[model samples]
Target: MITVLVIGIGTGSPDQLTTEAVAALNRTNLFLVPDKGADKHDLATLRRELCETLIDHDRYRFVEVPDPDRGPDAERATDAYRAAVAEWHAERARRYAATIRDQLGSDGTVGFLVLGDPALYDSTIRIAESIRDDGRLDLAIEVIPGISSLSLLAARHKITLNRIGQPVHVTTGRRLPEEYRPELGDVAVMLDGSLQCKQLLPKHGDLTIYWGAQLGLPDEVLISGRLGDVIDEIEAARNAARAQRGWVLDIYLLRP
Candidate 1:
């Protein structure tokens, strides 16, 4: 049986990797890296660099797998999204099974390195679930948590996530409402491409925002101020960065 370790390496920096995560990588015999086409080559390269820099073991083998793109389809229901993702994950599980059987021949420890904490908006855990659904993965699975972009973003700006005893809401850009419930203390929004911040400014009060793009990366962009004062700047910056890199990942925190 193959033992699988779903380890988080944090955002692009090796310094962000926890000692336990590094140790898990070194202990594994096989390392799995996912390639999401050219736009994401840097992501795969960063993982590769982490292995090269941190792991001293030469016996550890690396495997690169191409990910399937789930076509553009609206998922209004949770089951709809789950079904679509399950199909995508089924294909991925087949690849993983084939790789383990053909490449490693079983009885070895394998690591699937995730960009951030596996539980937070990452599909690695779902893929692992797919593997289990098929009864193909009979391995002992373990998870090693890493620093998340939220943690990094908050730390970079030197701000706590919430006000005293206040409830903080974490949400994605896609599902965010044009108007938010004013009772939430702080909103840490992620996976946002819609510029939801702009829509919320009309309802703004003492709202201040600390937003960061490409958190923890060299080309990271950060901005903060009254939501009304900086909404346009954030939009323009996001567009420019997207055009510059051909891709962009950003997150923001809203507090009052």
Candidate 2:
């Protein structure tokens, strides 16, 4: 059986790696890095840097796979979106299975480094399950937790996620409803490439927003203020950074 470690490397920052995560990295015989094409090549570069800095590169092998594209369809229909994502994931599973079979030893451990906690919005855990379900390979899976971008965003802003007795709602940009619910306390939005916060500002002008992009790395950008006050600033900054870096991963918290 091959032991697959789904290790969380923690949002582009090596320092955010926990001791357990470091240990998991050191135990890997192969590291699977997904190359999301030219626009996001820096992501794979970061993974390589992590491996080079944390473990002995000579003792382990690195496998790079081109990430599946989700297509340019703007299909907001529930079934259409589900179908698109499912198809993409299926392709990823095939790639993962091929790499495991071709590169991993029969009894050695392999690793897939995730950006945040695997339980969050990451799809690695789901992909692994799909591979296991296919039953083509003998696989044992282990997950190692690491600092999440959400937690790190709050830390960088020097604020707690929730107020006194308030609750926090975590969601993605696609699922963010058109209506704002004040009762939800605070909302942390992730995987949002659409600048959803800007759209919400017109409706909830009084709300406060804490936004951060490329959190942890040296080129990180942070903006926080009343939604109405800093909406344009955040938009400009996000666009400029994305154009400069060819890609961007940003998150924001909305407080009512």
Candidate 3:
């Protein structure tokens, strides 16, 4: 059986890797790195850097997989989006299965470094499930959790994710309705390419936003203030940072 370790490297920061995650890294026979092309080459570079810095031995080999494009049509309709994502995941499963069969030995261990915790907004788990269900390859999956970007954002901003006994609502930028508000407690937003905070500012003028981009990495940016006060500044800074680095992984928390 091939053992697959879905290890979270934690926001591209080697230091954020837990002891268990490091141990998992050392046991890896192959590390699968996804290449998101030139515009997002920094991500691949960071993964390579982590391997170079953390792995004590040279037994592990790195394999680069070209990520499938989500396609422009995916955004036009809900059904189209689901179909496109499903197709992309299928392609990923095929690639991963082929890699396991060719690059990994019968009992070899393979690792994929996730950005944050494997269970949070990551498709690696889903892809692994697909590969396991196919029955083409014997697989044993292990997950090693790491620090989440939301946790890092909260830490950097010196705030707690939840109130005294309230719950925290986590959602993506696209799924966040314009009328959404944190009536219960705090709200954390991720994968927000549209700067939904700006849209929320008018309705939630009293809300406070603690935002961070590229957390736990050098050149990280953090902005915190009343939504109305820092909306323009965050927008400008986000645009500049994305232009400078060619990519951004940003998350924010909203509290009333």
Candidate closer to the true structure by lDDT (higher is better), 1 or 3: 3
lDDT, each prediction: 0.82, 0.87, 0.87
Q: What's the lDDT of the predicted structure labeled candidate 1?
A: 0.82
- RMSD per model, one decimal: 2.1, 1.3, 1.5
Query: Per-residue lDDT of 1-256 in model 2, one digit per residue for the tens?
Result: 8988999988857798998998888999988888888888888988988988888556898888988889854456768888898999899989988888888646788899999888898888888888888886788899998789999999999999999988999987777766457888899998888777666765788999999998998889999999999989998989988998899889999999
Error of 2 at 256 (Å): 0.6
- Model 3 residue 169 distance off true place after TM-score fit, in angstroms: 0.5
Which digits, one per residue and each the tens of the lDDT, describe model 3 over residues 52-74? 99999999999988887778751
Least well predicted 10-residue stretch by lDDT in candidate 1: 71-80
**Which ranges of candidate 1 are over 4 A from the true structure?**
73-79
Best by TM-score: 2
Clashes of 1: 0
